[model samples]
Target chain A: MKARFIVSPVLCIGCRTCELACAFAHAIDGKLGKSRIYPIDGGFKELWVPVTCLQCEEAACVKSCLVNALQRNPETGAVELNQEKCVKCMACVAACPFGCSLLDEQHELVVKCDLCGGDPACARFCPTKALEYKPIKGSPKKIAV
Target chain B: MIRITINGKVTQASEGETLLKVIRREGIDIPALCHHEAVEPYGACRLCMVEITKEEWNGWSKYVTSCLYPVEPGLIVKTHSTKVIEMRKTIVDLYLARHPNCAEIQQLADEYGVTKTSYQTVVDGDNCILCGICTRICDEMGFHAISMVGRGHGKVVAPPLDEAPANCTGCLACAQNCPTHFIEFEDKGNSRTIWGKKFEMITCEKCGKTTITKEFADYLAEHRELPREYFNICDECHRRSTALDMGRIASWSKEVK
Candidate 1:
């Protein structure tokens, strides 16, 4: 199966280059439409953590989509949004476990990562390669407490 | 290409080039402390302050560090306005307060017309501007030995715990690049002290004079693929030996004739 988006906190230099790349790719006329990925400061002063959609197997956002706009692509296994079917409701925003979904104030639309249709721009422009996209074997289904 | 007016002189500047670079290219002097071409431009020293006036609806302009400020089209930049000069005077005065005895700081202050400062001087401490040049050089050279620690009044550039750094090679890169000459290097017999850490000095096999630390030589030999024989002699002795070998070879050729 295709590997998921992995973030390395150690490699990040808090440069916010990923935020700029994401905003540039998704923004309109220099107005950032709420970048899908957010670089949140970690416990230390210089530590940065790029928080984004993890594309969970048993996705909460997919299940919570009341309009059935969010659907998982069977081939790529990426949860994508059907803008036509979306009613601007923010159910998936609240339901997301990773806090990846957000409301774009400028466009008044809910936004989240669709993995850029299998080639994520944030991972591509990461200067330090803190974010990676690749393949993975069988992994643990549940988080270890 | 973009058109920018510096001191009312029209000049063409490439898009995204720093205002400091463009200003310097135009023979305009803007004093910057934390800017080095080798490393990234860190806007710490605030010495390269310039008033930038872009095409606007009103007569409003903003003060920005020319080092980090990018040149844009229809931008009006004034590097040494009365206000900018005054601001630089205050900045140099502040630096003078921290580094009271530093000749470079005194020179900068003098050049900016700052003779005295209202801020209290650090009497006993060494003059370190904390521009991060030394630390950045150390990191760039793959030493990662020294780093700036603490903040505000307690801020100091040293190894972790302010003790002898385990990874330090006594390379003197930090000392060599230090603008304020804050780093102290001293050699005593078979040991060298820097930042309160004494490292064992390696004696040159031929000259018998102290060279770099044995650990640093080994590290260079292992990590940098440098031959061990190169470290066996001091720089002076090595040069002399090379010259002697070349001379002997030349004389041998003459004798063969």
Candidate 2:
């Protein structure tokens, strides 16, 4: 199945509720109220782009992992990193042109959006409807002129 | 074994091997300085890049530093496509801007035929090449004595200014292992100079003619931990010095006998 997340930057309020919700969902306790949200390194809350993985057809992170740790989930259409298999090489981190992959606190592994198993918490939590997670029907085929 | 199409050519690689390694093993060369077989691929250089062909809708996308890329069955990879080459050239050019005079780097530039750097050399800056090789070597290999400082455009390799170590082992490992040859050393009579400027001097040991720079001699002596007398002059002058020492030894032997 092919899936895509559409981001409407125009509608984004820059409130960072999506970020907070993302962190909250991924938090150990899964409690938005009590969970401590860490700031995204090298970024500010004001310059927020309601970020969700593009799930690019040509995922650079999946291609760059030396340990065979990153793979495209054929089922979800999300690029996933197998943390146990990962060598913490940071190849995926550098290979990503979008600067989407972030180094985990250990500085070994990379952490990126996994689309939260299809029901994206970021999209659900967004008040401005900035994020839309939808299943794309068939592959986006180009017209042959 | 897994089959994949690289540059539209069918190739086979181990099931778990990275795409970078598979391509390299096939003799399709990709530039990567930070990658080493002994350690995990760092991917900081952004040099081993390739374009992977997805379905037609996405067309193509650029991926930098293929060292970590895993190969998948039926995966299509283009190591030298137009976009990949252009991005690699730009990255290499940026590295050149930080180290304009390194011979090794110049050679890579020549390979890509990069005549001009992407950006101007930072005013009055020392050699850096911006490859992150030094920082990686220190942290991964030497395990001490240095790290990267600052961030983004202001980033540089150095120890923290206020708390930098003084007893720097003078290992020369960082300099010797540097890909760009940006770090350098020069020993004068009393002191040693550690900077990035190039020095040329050649002196004849026998005739006392300046064959190469005195600075080169000093660099050798400092790095090798040799006495200044070893590099006092060029080869000719050194022969003369050795002959004089032999004569003194002969005289002393005769006197002792």
Candidate 3:
């Protein structure tokens, strides 16, 4: 099924569990994970919203890539960063509107979420249902991972 | 354009293009460990060895490392002939003897059906295959922080004087581009350790995320002429500020109406 990772600001407790989940899932060599999602203050008292890639339809990050490294995975509908072609010039870092594309300190490449290639760890480990990998309503239905 | 026959197929290539580049463009698989498009060919791995011949040489052929060999008119190349395969097998077998622990080397050996080494395995050896890619990439990145030290079996990639490289910006280009994944470094919290040197990494002011090392930032500021404040914020925070500025521009234009 075609899916997207969505976050509910109101339901987020700002526990940073999603951050931990993403970081843990992507960790290499026991290094601390470079989280693709993080909790940001949401203007009101005690209101923290976990922010992440919205996976925009016409992503600026994809456009700004010098080597055409960042691309859309058709099945997942997530922008995938091809590490081989990426030069780490940070053009995508400047192009992303919502700031989802960020630099990976260890790999020295700009990276963004890819819905974890199918099963998103952030949605799986989210304490609240704030983060979810929801199927598009009109897309293909109930194909198992 | 120059015409070169590769693997029984004639292809037109630009003058002086490396045979590996032209051969790769034709979808031929020639394993080159020390070869990186970002750096000049060092021919350290010799894995891309291919046999070449010409009609005027009376069928005599010479095996040359394709990464270093340039394409020439009327040159006939065999990328994976029996002799080329044998040479690659021998090279990979030597690599296996030296770097048995490295998964990359082991897998490469497996591809050539060289499960056991004919030479004595260096049990105490580490996975520096002496490919020189790391040192070359460092030089390409303008760091020159590491280089090939010593020679023969005792040769290794090390910083000068065996001390922490004072010029190392901790850019991780050397470690990240390592084909065998041999170069070692640690990035935990706001500090990074590599080449026996420790560097304090910069943290983003807005997002509190650790970014590049301070030395790398200062180097960019001095060499690339980037403002020192450019590295103060992480990419995400920088994008956020750009979005805010764009919003301000939109609102200001609206109010001016």
- State how far residue B121 of model 2 sits from its true place (Å): 4.5
Could you tell me the TM-score of candidate 2? 0.43
To one decimal place, how large is model 3's interface RMSD in Å?
A: 6.8
lDDT of 2 by residue, A16-80 (tens): 77777776776644433311112121132222344345666776556544345667777777787
Worst 10 residues of 2 chain B by lDDT: B234-243
Tens digits of lDDT, candidate 1, B1-257: 99999999999999889998899999987788777654567899999999988778278998999989888889999988999999999999888888888999999988988889879987875788889987886676567889999999888898988888888877665775576777788978999888778888767666787756776666665664545555666543443443344344434444556
User: Could you tell me the interface RMSD of model 2?
Assistant: 28.0
Pick by lDDT: 2 or 3, better one:
3
**lDDT tens digits, residue span A16-46, model 3:** 9889998988876887558988776654545
Mind giving the per-residue lDDT tens digits that candidate 2 earns over B80-164?
Answer: 8888888889987987887677676677789898988969875565667556655555454333556777898788777657253
Among all candidates shown, the one with the greatest DockQ: 3
Candidate 2 residue spans exceeding 4 A from truth? A1-145, B54-62, B118-123, B162-171, B185-257
Candidates ranked by lDDT: 3, 1, 2
Off by over 4 Å in 3: A1-145, B254-257
TM-score against native, each model? 0.57, 0.43, 0.68
Error of 1 at A107 (Å): 61
Tell me each candidate's i-RMS in Å.
Answer: 30.3, 28.0, 6.8
